[model samples]
Target: MKISFLLHNAYGIGGTITTTFNLAQALATVGHTVEIVSVLRHRERPNFQLDPRVGLRPLVDLRQEKEHPQHLRPAKVFPAAEYRYRQYSELTDERIGACLADIDADVVVGTRPGLNVHLALQAPERVARVGQEHLTLDNHPSRLRTALRRAYRRLDVLTTVTEADAAAYRRKMRLPGVRVEALPNSVPDPALPPADGNAKLVVAAGRLVPVKRYDLLIEAFARVVAERPDWRLRIYGKGEEHDRLRALTESLGLSENVFLMGAAAPMEAEWVKGSIGAAASNFEPFGMTIVEAMRCGLPVVSTDCPYGPGEIIEDGVDGRLVPVGDAAAFGAALLELVQDDERRHRMGRSALDNARRFAPGPVVAQAERLMEEAIEARRAGRPVSQDRAPMRQILVGRGYAARDAVHATGSSALRTVRKGRR
Candidate 1:
């Protein structure tokens, strides 16, 4: 089977990029033809190592194509309410549409909401259009949610990283013929041996963004430091919140106890360096870092966030979960593991064993099944009922499709007009 993934950017480092590359490589390893169609490319190569067997095709090269005719114009096909709206434009819409219209693959998966809208509205009827939601529905703006509800009806299958998000979609959105499923992100088993749960370090990694709640983690760690100053916390990742977090650490006199270790790709080494993993996010679509740490035999202590932490970590078993934004509870949870060596080691063993479910073998199997089912459904010519959405929503969705069609048709004329004016 030939599978193609449509990604916003493959050159960058992100959870979506990591998971997509992991799954694509896994598919290639199993003798299937897999390719990644990156919508934009800013760097010479991707930050993460990509398998040589898997092909990469970048549509718009940002390094050289900054002055394209329609590069500055806002995107019409991609929804304006989408978070990455400012990054997309008419040029991207055209490039992505042209690729999908002629793409040769049994399955084409979109990695983000904006790109998913493109795939759902533009991909050929014969191809299986699969959209992967890495973020929960509740996280999206109401306007964006409305847009997705209309556009997603045309999708063959919509997969969320967490089952809770899938349930939300099934209950909130009415996509009659679409198969909504939960497909956890794949994390390849580390090449190094798992951690032995002896280190005094506690590790947390992710973008140093506000939503990650690194401040909360630091506050929680302060409580731990007061009792056991020997234990240290290392946070890896670079983002806008670096200075603020550093200031907070200094203010609390935790400069020595908490260290802001900047971004480290291939965090397996870092995960093994710590005896415990930690996250204090207000929300997580799926806990990729939690699974990564668990794979390295570090039981994570994370906030029991809306969708992911509860699903990934079994409280008092493989890992511990505390209430969101509660530094006291989070600190106590960390202390529970820190104070007990035997229990920590046992939980680490359990974490390593249980995290295997997120390994490539099982995740790729689920992906293959989803793609196969979608293909079979398409081949059988199952009709998608229009009653899936209200008449108003259906018309709005059709308007989106029709507008894009018009944009494609008039591209040459608009370019000619601009050149004449110049």
Candidate 2:
């Protein structure tokens, strides 16, 4: 079978890019003709490695910056419903439409909500239309949710990374008979040996975004440092929250103990440097780092973030899950594992064994089976009346409008500001 993946940009180094490439490579290894269709290419080549067996195609080359170099202008062909609508243009729409209209693949997979919207509208019914939701349904803004409610009716199947997320989609969206399943992101086992649980280090990774709640982690780590002066914390990845987090670390007298390692490539090597992996995000769709760290044999200590950590880590088994935003609890979990080498090592072993649930073989086979089922269901002309959204928009002509989406974000921000004032 010919399998195609549609992505917003294949050049970036992110969880979605990493997972998509992993699955595409796995499919190719199993003898399927797999291709990645990148909607936009900012660089000459993808940051992540691509398998020789898989085909790579870019629909719009943004390296030279098309008609509007800045891309701050509103979109013409790209649907306004996509979160990054302002970055697209008439050029992107034409290229994507032209490419999808004549594609002959057996299954076309879209990796994000925006690209999924295009797949839903453009892909011929002959091929199974599969949409992968890396983020949780609750994380989506109301505007995007509205658009998805309308657009996803066309998809044969939709997959989420966590069961909690899958349940949310079934309860909130109108997918009718559309099969929604929780398919964890596949992370290949590390080539090197796993962490030995001897290092006095705890590591965390991800873009330094505010939603990651590094502030909470810093505070929690300060408490850990107070108790265990020999232990240190290292945070990987760079982002806008750098200054703020750095300041917090300094003010807490943790500048010497906590180091910010910016965007380390080959994160597996970094994971092995520490005995425990930590993530204190206030909210996470799925904690890819937690799995990556576990794969390298480091027991993870993470917040019981929405929809992910609880599902990935069996509390007190492979790792420990603390309540979100609880510094004392976070610090206590860190200390418990830090103080007890025997238990940490035991959990580390269990972590390595449990992480295989996301191994390439099982994950890819699950995806393949879903694709086959979706194709069969589509071929039978199964009506989606059972779960189609009551208010489906006619997006066959005009692109999704941004007016409502902007208000959705605006209202969310307003609520946050209001809560802060209270």
Candidate 3:
């Protein structure tokens, strides 16, 4: 089988990029031909390690390509309501559309909303269109949700990282025959040895964004320091909230116990250095870092964030889950694991055992099944079909269609002016 993935940018670091690379590598290892089509490349090389077996084809090399006349213009095909809208342009629409039209693959998967829109509306009807939603449906703005409702009808399958999110999509969004399934991200087992459950260190990793609630983690860790002065907390990752978090740490007088470690790639080594994994996010689409920690034999203590931590962690069995935004509860959970060595070790062992379900083998098998079914359905006369009249609304009222029409009008006028000059 031949599979191609449409990505926004593979050069940057994020959960979506890491999970995509893991799945692509697993698919390639299983004797399937796989390729990743990155839409834009600002750096010479990707931040994360990509498998040698998987081919990477980037359409727009921002570092080397000359400025195009349409590079500054807004994208028509890619939905503007998407969060990454500012990064896309008319040049991307032309490039991605051309690539999709001429693509030679049985299946093409999209990793994000904007790229999914391109795959849905532009990809050849013969190829199986699978749109993978890394984030939940409700997280998107109302305008983006409306745009997706209009465009996603063409997709054969739509996958979410969690079953909770998948249910939300199936219940709220009406994509007639599209198969909405839950496909969690795959995480490969670490090469390093598992943590010994003896270290007095607690580790947390992810972007320093507000939704991650790293500040809350810091405040919670202050309680841990008050009880066990020997234990230390380290946070890895850099973002806009770095200085604010550091200031908070100093103000709390947790400067000795808390250390802000910058970003580290291939964090398996770092995971093994600590005995406990921590996540205090108020909202987590899917807790990728939490699974990484578990795979490395460190039981995570995460907040019961919507749609992720609960699904990943079997509370009190493999890991502990506290109420979201409850600093005292979070601190107490960490201290519970900190004071009791036997329970912590037992949970870490359970964590390592349980996290295997998220490993590449099982996750890849599920993905393969989805792709195979989608392909079989496409090859047959049956395809995802629904009446257009019931769903169709005024294009002018829908956000994306209206903007696309305006862009088309401007382009037409420019073409006419160029012809007159000639």
TM-score of each: 0.90, 0.87, 0.90
| Per-residue alpha-carbon lDDT of candidate 1 for residues 272-391, written as tens digits (9 for 90 to 100) | 999999999998889899999999999999999978887778788789999999999999999999999999999999889767767776667667767877887777787332222222
Model 1, residue 392: what's the lDDT? 27
lDDT of each: 0.87, 0.82, 0.87
Candidate 2 lDDT over 305-370, as tens digits, reads 887887778778789999998989999999999999999999999889767766675566567767
Stretches of candidate 3 above 4 Å error? 384-422
**Candidate 3 lDDT over residue span 82-124, tens digit each:** 9999888999999999999999999999999989999999999
Residue 83 miss distance in model 1 (angstroms): 0.4
Clash pairs for candidate 3: none
Q: Model 2 Cα displacement at 335 (Å)?
A: 0.8
For model 3, what is the alpha-carbon lDDT of residue 313? Answer: 84
